[model samples]
Target: MTPLLNYIVSHTKLPEVSIKNTVELLNEDCTIPFISRYRKERTGNLDEVQIGDIVKFKEQFETLEKRKAAILKALEEQDALTSELKQKIEATQDLTTLEDLYLPFKKSRKTKAETARQNGLEPLAKIIMSQNVNDVESVAYKYVKGEIKSVEDALEGARHIISEWINELTDIRNNIRQQLERFAMISTKVVKAKADDENAQKFRDYFEWEEALSRIPSHRLLAILRAESEGFIKVKIEIDDEKALTKIEDRIMRSNNDCTEQIQIAIQDAYKRLLLPSLSNEALQNAKTKADEAAISVFAKNLKQLLLGSPLGEKRVLAIDPGFRTGCKVVCLDAQGGLLYNETIYPHPPKSDTIGAMKKISSLTEAYQIEAIAIGNGTASRETEAVIRKIHFKNDIQVFVVSEAGASIYSASKIARDEFPNYDVTVRGSVSIGRRLQDPLAELVKIDAKSIGVGQYQHDVDQTKLKKELDVVVESCVNAVGVNLNTASTSLLSYVSGIGPKLAENIVAYRDENGAFTSRNEVKKVPRLGGKAFEQGAAFLRIKEAKNPLDDSAVHPESYAIVEKMAKDLGKHVTDLIGNKDQLQNIDLKKYCTETVGLPTLQDIINELEKPGLDIREQAKVFTFNQNIKTINDLREGQLLPGIVNNITNFGCFVDVGIKESGLIHVSNLSDSFVKDVNEHVSLHQQVIVKVLDVDVPRKRIQLKLHK
Candidate 1:
């Protein structure tokens, strides 16, 4: 095993793994999820993420091994395999070094050696290299056979053989490749398009430029390459030929002899035809792969920030899926997300009945005591907002423009239909939009996360890798904020530890028939929820208003007896010991410590006991966008505008300004001082007030200062 892989296993306290065993397991069809859950004993309970890292490293190791085997086989076939060559191949850690070692033995297209051999000048060429020639012309004249009819022809054939021998030296080829890759620059020139061609304007930015291969970012490289392929640009990789030739000559030239000139010509041919093209292509491909990885990494980071964005918290909300022709689909949801009512109202042109819509909204607000209004930021959303603003309610109800990026997709989803079989698609969409505002985690699971549109270049990334990564993000979010066992949908519950689709459905089914679980112990009574399942999942599940208050908290059932013992020692009931700061501080915590209760476990217990069933989510603060500012024209310099952060990148943060599009708050404008990363200043879904600093209406680029 490599030191890095061994270190990872040792530091993680995971199972002892041999290099061969890991490679074999990774080569099999077993998935990360399967191995993590079902084969826990084999992997020593390493989670999916750790196992995935192991699998990736294992694949890399195997690829390196395969490359070594290929090099050895090719060399053996050519009868050039020696103990030194075999040792070098076995010791090679990277593909580049292995290829360097195998360069001499690799088969190539028709070469000078075969040509010289066919011309019957092999004996003369051997005599030249043997350096026994007192007179070169006399030796060359001796091999003037049928193919070599003249002294010049015979010398040329001998020179070809000598050139081939010089090119076959592996060390010389390796040196040339290294120097070229380091000093190369790719140049691109755009071809002038036809006068009437529309593509001409699109490719104007990349008309001409030369850049180092290492310096070009992936997005720009891909864009420029695409333009070149479309006939608007010409691109080529160039290296300083004089410098390259000198480096090649320095390595191969030993002394002044007739063979020296032939070797020089051979090195140039090898470099131009074989080595340069191959190495340049490899470097370009490697650069592109690196760029893709960086972009995908950024996308994954953005996705994680978006997925972990704060939920609006549970509230009785009225959601409106705004539309002009089809009318606005409205749904009222109670605090627990149970659908209270549904209706449709048109408040725009063709059926512009504002009064009727206002009456319906007012009645629903009063009936449900709606605390907030979630307006879907889709077509006719502003008109719907105007209608709601005009309605006078008994209590203040704040309206919010919820991002309906995937609400329609979720409505058309099978899971949505399965959840609400009788409801129309529009009604389902409205409910989803409303529930997202109430609790994003519960509603987002029904729709594909990629459709949420919060990341950079999401669609361009590897689909399988993206899906797996996003699934993990979703899982982390769902678990971080504990699921509500009694009210959570099966989709939401499935993300909880040790609970999958079938198990979540069974739990929900058991709840439907047996009523709400009164205690954590009641879970085992449900069918298929065995001891192991409960052991893995029980700590994350919460039972609000259960018989024991500790059951409502994240404290595990096994630790319940520990808390009970502490309570008894303190001469108080468990409930009295919980949240009783003055009395709890007086008791010695060391008495409660056991072999299983380390400092980490003790701290967790103390935190749980201090705030039993404490919901970590803070109540979302109320804010509203200014109604007067509907367009860029309405925005003024230094005017503070309330908005939610839509996305964050390395360069800046994008804020939704309620103008159908978002504005960029460049990294420089994010704070009073320098900002290293956008995530450090703001996160997705964070509400902030920004001051508009500049606007370019033509480009639709609005710059804002987030310094306030």
Candidate 2:
């Protein structure tokens, strides 16, 4: 605990007491969302990201300690655990340094050095390393016996042992690592045999590329590595041999003698055959780790933005999964996104039943009482939207062009299958499109974040790290926008603080067996939802029109007594105090302050009372792309077109300009000045107008600049 305390405090530079309390809570199995939201006083108002950092460092510290224990045990078994060595091993903070300290003790397949040591050449190697033995052949002759053919063979064995010794020197390896960190260059060359392959052309930019390993952008490095992995290129890291060798020789060679010359040969062998190769891989791996983190950060950010995108809010929707040759698949959904009707309509090419499609859509809108029409932004989407908008409906129906990025994936997922066993993929896909417009967060959680198409080189990054980060983002967003206890699916409820998949399923099963939860306390009746689970998860679950009015709010059950006291002082009932801004503002917050509850908690309570159970996202808006532009062929330079930002990365954001090829708004084109973060200028699903800068029709590329 002390090691973890110091590690988190040093890494995060957070308040010591706050970090200490937060670590204690984390060790107690409190979720980040729970600690950040409900336990604010204990955590000193740390947000989810800060708490998440503490969790990351805590896990890292645990992993380091485990490795240290394993290494220490292995050393003790090998009879190599000296007091000084044990102290060094225990005191090292990072895995790389700890592994470096344990490198010589690692058991591996027998090597040339081990063979030489078995032949009893270590003593002779030590004699040569002293650099005072001018008569090296005389010393080498003494070791020439049993597996040693001559003095030359014995000398070669001694050099091998000396090279191994040089390789094992921790200072020498650390020095080489430092040099590689500063000056290593990563280079890639095209695999001539695969140069002209069609699939390899996507990576042609990296065929002949060279960059300083320390300075390359994460995206570029990922691209180069991906190209190498796909057999399109060969990647290598290098530094000047003379510079590395000179640094090593200066540390080892003391005098110019025959022994010094032999030591020099061993040094060369150590640098080329052992140290350089090993350290170069370490540097590359470290760079890869950095790249994976950067890429995963980008992915997590995009996923969060996409998950929390604007919700149209429980409107009956008529959704269409558009297509050209196969015709459009349409489904009518209720306010709760339950599919009521599904059918196919041909509105575009090959079928060209535009009039019939419009008539069917108008009738469906009237029959199903749809308040909004959700059109999938996929094949022939504009054509479908055009057909739907042409109709003169009885009521105003808002038209939303929903991004169908992962709808297909979700439609085919087991969750979707389980939810709709009687329905097929197309019907499930249309339902997803409608539900997404109704509530993006609710529908998006059903699909894997990586499949949702809001990432940069997501497939090329570290998959395990990517999954962990994206899951955290999902859980954070799900809890930030409290779930409805009555309506939330198992997938959505699973992300609630402390309510994992099993508990969520149990809660759902309990709800089904009995009825809708009537109050916060009723959650305890669910099997296995003990005191800790209820304490951690209850605040994030909202119940509408519950028996207790506070049950529908973010005000946790434990704070109900305090709110009741505030209401009592106001001479009003708790129900009357809620949403009464005039009365809420008049209450003196400090009057309710106690040792357990502080001003922060009181303020949050007051804020929640004002707008209890309110969503943190905005209402979804209708967007329109240029009617004049339907395809890339219609695009022209300087043509201003309405676009939606569908994906964002560090380098730039891609905009859907009502075309098959989404235009790339390079970071340089995002602003007149330098753009450090593309998200600062735009977000996922943001509508903006842009001017087309270039259109490569043949290559299916479109470049755009933000129009002021």
Q: Which candidate is the best by TM-score?
A: 2
Best by lDDT: 2
What's the C-alpha lDDT at position 625 in model 1?
Answer: 76
Candidate 1 local lDDT, 246-265, one digit each (tens): 87777766666765655566
**lDDT tens digits by residue: candidate 2, 477-530:** 999999999889999999999999999999999999998989889999999999
lDDT scores in order: 0.75, 0.92
Off by over 4 Å in 2: none
